[model samples]
Target chain A: MKPRVGATLASTTDQTTVIVVRWGAEDLDVTCGGAPMVDARGPEAGTSHPADPAQQAGTVMGKRYASEEHGVELLCTKPGSGTLAIGGVPVPLKDAKPLPASD
Target chain B: MNITVLLDMAADGFGDRVVVGTREAGLTAQALRARASAGAALVEAEGADAILHLAVNTPAFPVALFAAGLAGVPLVPVNYRLGAEQLDHLVGNHPRALVVADERQRAAIERAGLTARTPEEFLQQTRTPAPHAVEPREVDPDSAAVVIYTSGTTSAPKGVVLTHANLVSYVLGTVEYGAAAEDDAALMSVPPYHIAAVSNALTNLYAGRRVIVLEAFTPQDWVETVRDQGVTNAMVVPTMLARIMDEPGLDRSVPSLRSLAYGGAAMPRRVVEQALREWPAVDFVNAYGLTETSSTITVLGPEDHRAGGERLSSAGRAVPGVEIQVRADDDTPLPAGTSGHVWVRGEQVSTAYAGGGSGSSLDADGWFHTRDRGRLDAEGYLFLEGRVDDTIIRGAENIAPAEIEDVLQRHPDVADAVVVGVPDEEWGQRIEAVVVPRRGVDLDAEALEALRATVRGSLRGAKTPDRIVAWAELPRTPTGKLVRRDVVAGLAR
Candidate 1:
């Protein structure tokens, strides 16, 4: 699915949820624990899906996972024991440098 | 994209951290979240479309903001300083709003035929169990999160609508998650109506920092609050910083202050220099942006202040998600160092006004044309040269008033200065300046001529002010923005 920015996605295998912050690639194969995620606002959001235990690397809340080549970024809203991947390649956690608060 | 997500993140990440009020008796992130739920219930019960904040800085400000997101309504913060007529006109726009007003605004709220609650009353409501259970509702990202009315120079004030997407993009792009230490606190002095207040509340809370509100701003009160509250961070306007420097008989030592950000208007070089010398340990940031944008777009960091040459006067580079472009009168893009009109484009920029008034709206290309005339240096640092409308157009040449004003302010005898264009038969417009004298020195005939000579030495002869009038003080807004229209009217009289 080619979801827009600010779209929320949830994993069926567990209580993993994320908000899409940036997107560029046309085709999306976003997976959590080897199962495709569904729209968080859809009826199937919290339903159970088949899971593979080997893909469980865990997603952390408040951590941003990104893939530079695909230009994809996601902010983890709920922690779950599943790695977030696009087309089966795990995205790395982005290192964040804090800026001085300038209001 | 809802702003409530930030509150939820803070509550989930650092539930026990104090995020609001006094350090001794402040609300933790978890408590604030619960209060937000109850506030949302109150809003739902009232059937209000908006929460109109007609008061000063209070804890109710944040509660209403978060509650609005939960109820999928906009938070409209109106300036309480407006007169009766202006207040009535503004209050009319939001008839179906739950107004949280102060005691002085009682008559205005009553005149509008709306029931109003005090900030204290609203705070108390949040403490008690909600009348109804409220589950956090997700709002459309494109919906308005805030509506801030800005007083214009020529027309009635217009409301700048800030969307949830705009605010969320700004917060996520600029701040790192969980950045603040356990004990870090921020002292907020800007009024609740201003975008600085809203932006600061979101940024500080998301960073897991405590925020203490200084209801009204006095230099002595601000200094004492910083020391007493253990404030590690603070934000102020140039005028407030100037007053802090000028105020005497106060212990100005702020050892706990780690960062100080000042903006809303241009900073006097003298005041900035003195502040840097006085607080050598504090990190300084010069933030520049408009109410149309969420908050800051360009910032001169602490390292830039330490480097401190010509860039100190500049507005520094654009923030991560924003792009700045300089264009000529013909709409052609200008290269670096060429002064022209400034245009900006970013997700955080909301160029649209609520009820269309007179102002620049966003173009088809998503670029918001700013009234400012500025230039970017070779290294992409922005140097603002006053407003384009404020530019002095002579027979042919367009002159910037800020250049002359800077020179006038630099004169030893002059404490403040304002350069304006007055009507003239020979030139389309002639340069006129108003100068305020330093405490002890008299800006007599000799001193005025000396000040003119200083401007002549720096700029060309034509750029000099033809008539220099001495005034006790120049007119300005509370945030130090010049009331040029008022000044021109005063000069005409």
Candidate 2:
């Protein structure tokens, strides 16, 4: 699916949800828990594949997953038993670059 | 598109980090989120339509903010310093709100006959989990996230409607996520009702910086807190800066202070220059914007101050994703170096106000009429002349009081100055000024005459003040904005 900033996506297997925080201009294959993520409402009930062990590294709520090569960032809104991947490659968590605190 | 998304990200990114209050026992990211989650459940259980925060800035303030967002309702932060009649009128507007207030503000809540909770009690109630995991609804981007009341210096206060999109755009555009150093702490001195307070709360948290709020402000206390807390960044109004710069026999050293931002009113050239000289290691930023614009649209970075000269007074260039223009009365675009009405169009700009729907002060093309008279230089530097309403018409010539007052403030004897237009049978309206001379210097005729001559030398004779009086101090809002109406009445008296 085309990855866009501020767009929400939901996992097919479980209740995992994520929002794209930053992304490059080009479209990329973004998936959660070994299945293609659908819109905020998710896909029809039975269309999802059963959770796979290799892809079930599991996601923690509120963690961010990013692909530096593709310049894509996703914020996990819900936890699930699936890893975030781009083009079938597992994406690594990106570290935050701290700014001077200005209130 | 709910505001809670920001909080959720923060909790997940650094759940154990202290994001609010003192570093030792401040509320952690996970704690804040849990409190907000529990508080949202309370809001739902009470069936409240909105959350009305009528207290000073506290740890509970941020919890209430995100809780209200998770509850799918607007958070209305009202000024607690308003007069009885004004306070009553504003309180009456929110009958279905959950009133969260302090002891000093309990009267307004009691008068409204609504169930109220103190900040401590509010925090305690949110400690327990609800029957089920409270999930925040997917709110629309255009839903009202917060409604901030204007200072109402010229007229009755009106609620400025800021949607989730307006505030989210501001944070995402201006701030990078988790951008603060692990030990960085931000000292916030602005009041709870100000837009800076709301925006600052969210931005500082999202940046993973610990926030320290000074419920009350005094120069001594502020400096001491900075020194003790090792605060890395801070924000202040012009008056607060002036007070800090002029505090007598005080230790002005803040070794950890790296960035200081001043806004909410025009900064005198002398004060800013002194600040830059005294704290050479510190970076000074001049952020210019309004509540309707979601805080800052233009920023004069520290480099501009080092440039010195006339750039000292310039409000600097627009921030990213924002466009600024100067327009004549007929909506014609003005050329650079020509003073006219300032207009701004941007995603962060909230062109909507309560009672009046979206696009009230904005044109059909989405440009918001700032109602501020200013000029843009060829390099895109914005120089504010004053408000359109503050212009003095003297013999058909539009004279900006800020222009004359700026010159007056530069004088060695002048500590503060304000120029106002007094009704006159001749010349339509004559320019009158009130000057607050430096301490220990009497406002003698010689000093007043020298001020008049100085203004006359730089500006046209018609622009000079016809009558300049000496006042111990001028009336100003709590946020350092001059009360022009009060000044006009003072001149009349």
Candidate 3:
């Protein structure tokens, strides 16, 4: 499914949860811990498949996971053992520089 | 979706860091959350639907705000500068509200037969854990998060309602979560009632920046506070920046300050020019928006300030996720450089009022009529002429001419009165009134002073005319409608 902005996703394998902040591509399979994460509101929001040990590196809350190559940004609203992946490749955590306070 | 998400994320992300007040003794993210939870218990016990903040900027302000969020209530921060009757009228809006008022304004709150707690008492009360702590309730994003009362062209003040969705969208669209460095602090000089104050609290906290408040503004005190506090970022109105730049022989050197944002009114061209020379190291940003639009919709970034010469006067381009356009009265889009009413559409824009309001401001196409006259350059830089409505914005406060005019016309000796805003170096616009005297009465200098005093007697000091002049007649159309531009031109002459 094409992940829409503001759509929350929870890991089926672990406690990881994320909100899609920005999306640039039309179709991309977003996964965490080698398991396809389900919509937070869906019945399969958790525990569909066991997390792959190799990909279970974990995610930190409030840290953004983004793949420049894949054109996607996901903010880790809730952290867990499952790491975020965009189409099977683990996305790097690269935070953008702080803009000057405008308020 | 709720604003609590931001606070919760901050608490977990950096719970130990002092996100508010002095670095030595401010509330940490975790402490703020605990206090908010404790405060929520109090709110639920009182059965209040809203939390009214009738005080200056304080640490307790944020506590009350989050407490309302946690308890599923809206936080209504009102302008304390208003007159007693006005204050009472606004306080009456929420009879079942928990008011955090200053000592001076407590009587008005009490007069309304509502319970009022001083900010200190509120802090003290929230410090203790309630017998039964209320859990964070899942709030509807569409519900009102903040209601601010602002006087527009009409004499009556209408409450502008901002939902959690609008605020959350503003933060999510503009701010990167936990982006501030551990030492980054922002000094806020704007009053608690303004939209900037609410947005600043949410955005700065979400960015992990420490928040500091300047209750009283003196150019000397402001400069020294930045230096003493090691404040990295700050927000001010145009007047504050103007005084800091023009005040001769003041120690203005601040090595710690990095960014200074000025807004709330049209920035004087001379002030902006001098400030650029005075503090070349500081990243000066010009943010322009209204209470209806959840703070900043357009921003003149630091890069544009130095390079863009003529565009310095411009309010700059729209921020991300927001679209800006210039349209005629007929709702047709205007071409570049043609001045017309400014219209904006975004996730952050809230056209709703506390009640249904006068009428729908949003059109069938979903664009909000900003009621501001401005033209967009080919590059999309917005140059604002002024507001289409005759609301006079003096510094940060919006004053209705009709409100003061009604008072002037009430005096027995006064025949006719028209209050208008005149451009000034200090105040972006100063209030000036032209009066027509009663038949056979002398409209002398004394009479002008008397008329000024008459307005002061009826209204607040901020609403009183700064200068009053006597005129034989006022320029009006055949239908007897005011020709505001002509009056302004006559005042200039």
Interface RMSD of candidate 1, in Å, is 1.4
lDDT of 1 at B444: 86
Regions of model 1 farther than 4 Å from truth: A13-15, A48-57, A95-97, B357-360
The lowest-lDDT stretch of 10 consecutive residues in candidate 1 chain B is: B351-360
Better of 2 and 3 by lDDT: 2
Per candidate, native contacts kept equal 0.74, 0.28, 0.61
Classified by CAPRI criteria, candidate 2 counts as acceptable
Q: Rank the candidates by DockQ, best first.
A: 1, 3, 2
Query: lDDT of each structure?
Result: 0.88, 0.86, 0.83
lDDT (0-100) at residue B389 of candidate 2?
A: 91
By summed lDDT, the worst window of 10 consecutive residues in model 3 chain B runs over B476-485
Q: Enumerate residue pairs that collide in model 2.
A: A97-B179, A98-B179, A98-B180, A99-B179, A99-B180
Point out where model 2 deviates above 4 Å.
A1-7, A10-36, A44-102, B357-359
Q: Estimate each model's TM-score.
A: 0.96, 0.89, 0.78
**Candidate 2 lDDT over residue span B62-114, tens digit each:** 99999999988889998989998898888888899988888888877888888
Regions of model 3 farther than 4 Å from truth: A1-9, A20-30, A36-49, A53-60, A63-74, A80-98, B151-155, B357-360, B391-493
Q: State which docking tier applies to candidate 1.
A: medium
Reference contact recovery of candidate 3? 0.61
Best by lDDT: 1
